[model samples]
Target: MSGIYIHIPFCKQACHYCNFHFSTSLRLKDEMINAICKEITLRKNYLANNILNSIYFGGGTPSLMNADDLSKIFETINKYFQWSPESEITLEANPDDVDNKKLKIFKTYGINRLSIGIQSFFDADLKWMNRAHNSKEALDSIKVAQGEGFSNISIDLIYGSPTTSDDMWKKNIELALESDVPHISSYCLTVEEKTALFHQIQHKKTTAPDLERANIQFDALIKSLTSAGFDHYEISNFAKKHHIAIHNTNYWKGQSYLGIGPSAHSYNGQSRSWNVANNKKYIDSINKEILPIETEFLTPSIRYNEYIMTGLRTMWGVNSDEISVLGDMYRVHFLSNIVKEIDSGLVHICDDQYVLTERGKYFADRIAMNLFFVN
Candidate 1:
């Protein structure tokens, strides 16, 4: 099965640490929606399978769009692709943008899942991140969404922020547990280049995230969440039984998906492509019936490395049999490289699947790099 990701490139305000393609202005909202629908039609045949297991509305903040905007896009998608009652339709929302009316509207559009961007539960942390929502809104949003019957909800939380003390971080996790969402995606604060947070750190205006502190918090997060019956399914994701994110899990499992809108990426098993990051350029191209995308065909070596990179970051781990399908040389390279990791207790084999140990989780990327099939 395949999936589609629709990018809504508009936000009410910019977060301090975000570098994703987005416009804070709503000047081109109507035009952008038209362009997105057009692009959806233009790339109808991109996914080999016409049946979609999932459709994700990601952002900038999908909740910023009105019901009419969502309806238009949904109509366009329905005209081109097919999804059933069991299919997962997700919308990424901000706390401030959520209300009973909006929640009902989203439910009417068949959005079975809501991934709320609740980065922190403290007012200080919210201000530090320049998020559009405050601490109270964060909790209220979850309560309201739950009240509206959005059981398959996930919340994004950021740890290791300069403004979040250990106590605050613990409180955040505790509050999240109390809120009782089925899935949680958490990440450590990283200052990406060209972001306000990076500039602040470079100018010594604010402190950078402390790695040691982050490590401790990560341990706390794992202990707290796992104890609460959440599976650490992916490196950055935890889910209750049967509640894993189908769209994102498909990505980790090397499934093909089509991404629409500015700065969106698509992979179709053999190659990868991404749309132009500029909203105006994307709209202009789609208006002219042209796809503003760059494509890169994946070499066997590249594909193998990608599998290794993504596979290791999940509970599914890398499969020896799958590696053999790439080529004998790749299998040889993997076998040779993995021995050292296995010997070091960083990885272990269970029925030929090289799964990471708890300690290895800390060095997931590094381990993947070490095991790469260098040409």
Candidate 2:
């Protein structure tokens, strides 16, 4: 099954640590929406006509879009592509954008899932991140959505920020559990280049994130969520059984997907492409009936490395047998290199498949890097 992703590139304000492509200005919002619809028609074959199992409205803050705007985009998708009745339609919303009124609009537009960006439940952490919503709004929105009958919900949480104490972090987790949402995506705060957080750390205006604290919180998240009966299906994601995000899981399984809009990426199994990051440029090109994007075909080594990187991050570990599908040499090399890790208890053999141990998960990036196909 394939998926479609539409990026809405406008946000109310920039977060201190966000490097995502978005404009705080809505000057080009209408034009961008029109262009994205046109792009969907122009690139309808990107997923090779696979039935769409998921349609994700992600971005600067998709919840900012009105019902009519969302419906117009959905109409374009329905017209140009095959759709499944059971398809999961998700919208990423900021806490400030979610209210009873907006949630009703979302239901009317066929948005079956809500991925709320509730970074933290504390006002201090919200201020530190520059999130537009306050603590009350954060708590209120989720309850509002639930009150409006939206059961399929996911919330994002941020940990490891300077303002986040372990006590406060536990409260955030407790808040999520109390909200009774079935899914969560938790991330650690990181300083990315060109972000305000980066500049602040570089100028010593704020201290850099403490890796130790981050690790501690991550461990806390796992323990707490697991105790709450959440499945650790993938790194950074926890869900109740049958509530895993189909779109992200399809991505991890290397399924094809079409992405429409500026800065959106599309993959059709063998190659990947991304639209131009400039909003105006993308709008102009699509208005002229052109797909403004760049693409790269994957080499075997690149694909192999990707498999290891993504595979090991999931509960489903990297399979040595799957490497043989690439070629015998890849399988041989991976098995030989992973032997040491297996012996060290960083990885374990489960039913003939190699999966990362819980301890190994903390070092997932380092382990994946070591296993990269460097040739």
Candidate 3:
């Protein structure tokens, strides 16, 4: 099944830790939406088959768009894209932008799933991250969405922040569970270059994230979620049975998708393309009838490396038989490389599938890299 992703590169405020392409100013919001719709029409045939199983509205902050703006974008999709009757349409939102009225508009536009960014259920943590929503707003937003009958929901939680302690982290987990959402995506705090958090660390205004505490919090996440009957489907994603995210799971499985708007990336199994991160440049090029994007044809080595990277992080693990598609030589290389890991009890064969053991999940990245093909 195919999927489509449309990036809305606008945010109401800049979070200190975020490095995603977005603008705090709304001066070009309308033009950006128009350009996005045009881009959709231009790249209508990107996916192999015209049938889509999902469409995800992701970005700096998709909820920052007004109801009218979102309506226009969805209208354009209906005008061109042919999706299944059961296609999962997801909108990523921030707590500050959610309310009963807007939630109703989301339903009207045929958005069936909501992924809310409620980083933490604490005002102190929110302020530390420079997020726009408070704890009260976070809780209220989920309630409002549920009240409006939007049940297929996911909420993002951030742990391991400097301001988050074990107690506060537990509270955040409890709060998310209380929201009764089927899915939760939690992540550790990282200081990427060019972010306000990075600057703060360099200037000594804030300390770097503590890896020890982060590891502890991650262990906490696994215990808490699994005990709560949530499947630890991926490194950062957990879901109730049969409620796995269609868009993200498809991406992890190497399925094709089309992405519209600035800074969005699209994959078609053998190649990938990404639009210019600059909004002005993206709009100008689209208006001039030029798609301002760069494309790359992934080599077998590159594709194998990517599959190993994404596959090892999920519950499904990498398919050993599918490795033949990469080439017999590469498949032999992968098998040889993973021998030590499998013997070390970090990875193991289950029936015919390979998956991470609970202990190895903590060091999945290191394990994946060890299996990467270098020529």
Candidate 4:
């Protein structure tokens, strides 16, 4: 089944570590929403008549949009596309946006899933990240969402920030578990080029992030979540049974999806496309009845690389049979090269597939890169 991803590229404030496309200005809010709705209709045929199984509201901060905005978008989707009664609808929100009133508004819409960005439950770390909410608000948001009867909820957390000690990291996980949320997405804090964090380290204004501490945090996360009976389905995601994010899973599995709004990407099996990242350009282009997107046709080598990269990161592993379907010379190259990896205890050979062991998961990208065809 296909999916839809709508990017709302605006935030109330910029975090020092963010490299995503967003503007702090709300002046363009109404114009942006109109552009997004126009985009939905403009790209309706991109899905190629596939029934949509998931609709994800992702962004600079989807929570920034009020209920009326969400209602109009949902209405447009229902009016234009084929949707299932049980389609998984998810909205990504920040903790500051999840009071009782807002949560009630969310429920009245068709949103069945809520992904709250609660980077950390410690005020010190929150301030370091320039988050809009404090520790109390983080917990309060979860309580209010739960109190409003939202069960399929997920919280995003960041680990290994300079401000997060090992004890504090454990506390953050414990706080999330204690909150009774069913899903959690924990990511290692990284310093991207041109980000404020990067500049700070370059200028010695702040200490560089500790890679060792980050690795330790990841190991601890695995141990703790496994003990808590959460399934480590993806590298950074843990969830109770039946609660893994459907939209993201579809992405990893290479299912077709249409992405609307600025800076969003779409894949329809054989080809991929992406809209312009500039907000004004996106709005102007769409207003002219032109879908401002670039297209790419995947070569076999590109598809193979993508498959290996995504497949080996999950518990499902990469199937040799699937690679074999790509044809013989390619299959021979893969099997022969994988021999060294298997000997190194980095990958295990199952009946007809190869999957990473725990240690291998840490070098997933490196391994996948090595397996890519050089031609």
Best by TM-score: 1
Note the residue pairs that clash in candidate 4. Answer: none
For model 4, how does the per-residue alpha-carbon lDDT over 1-375 read when each residue is reduced to its tens digit? 889999999998988898887888888889889889988987777787658899999989998889779888988888778776588889999888888878778778878899999999999999999888999989988898888888999999999899999999999989989998999999999899978889888999888789899999898898898799898888889999989989999888889999999999999879899999999999999999899999999877778788888888887888877877677767788888888888889999777668888888788888998899877
Tell me how far candidate 2 lies from the true structure as C-alpha RMSD in angstroms: 0.9
**What CA RMSD would candidate 4 show?**
1.2
Error of 2 at 365 (Å): 0.4
- Best candidate (score: lDDT): 1
Q: Which stretches of candidate 3 lie over 4 Å from their true place?
A: none
Candidate 3 overall Cα lDDT vs. reference?
A: 0.91
Can you list the residue pairs that collide in candidate 1? none
- Per-candidate clashes come to 0, 0, 0, 0
Q: Is candidate 1 or candidate 2 better by lDDT?
A: 1
User: Residue 70 CA error for candidate 3 (Å)?
Assistant: 2.3
Worst window of 10 by summed lDDT in candidate 3: 76-85
On the 0 to 100 scale, the lDDT of residue 20 in model 4 is 82
Could you give candidate 3's per-residue lDDT for residues 302-352 as a string of tens digits? 999999999999999987788879898889998898889989999988875
Give each prediction's root-mean-square deviation over alpha carbons.
0.6, 0.9, 0.9, 1.2
lDDT for model 1: 0.95
- Evaluate model 4: give its lDDT: 0.88
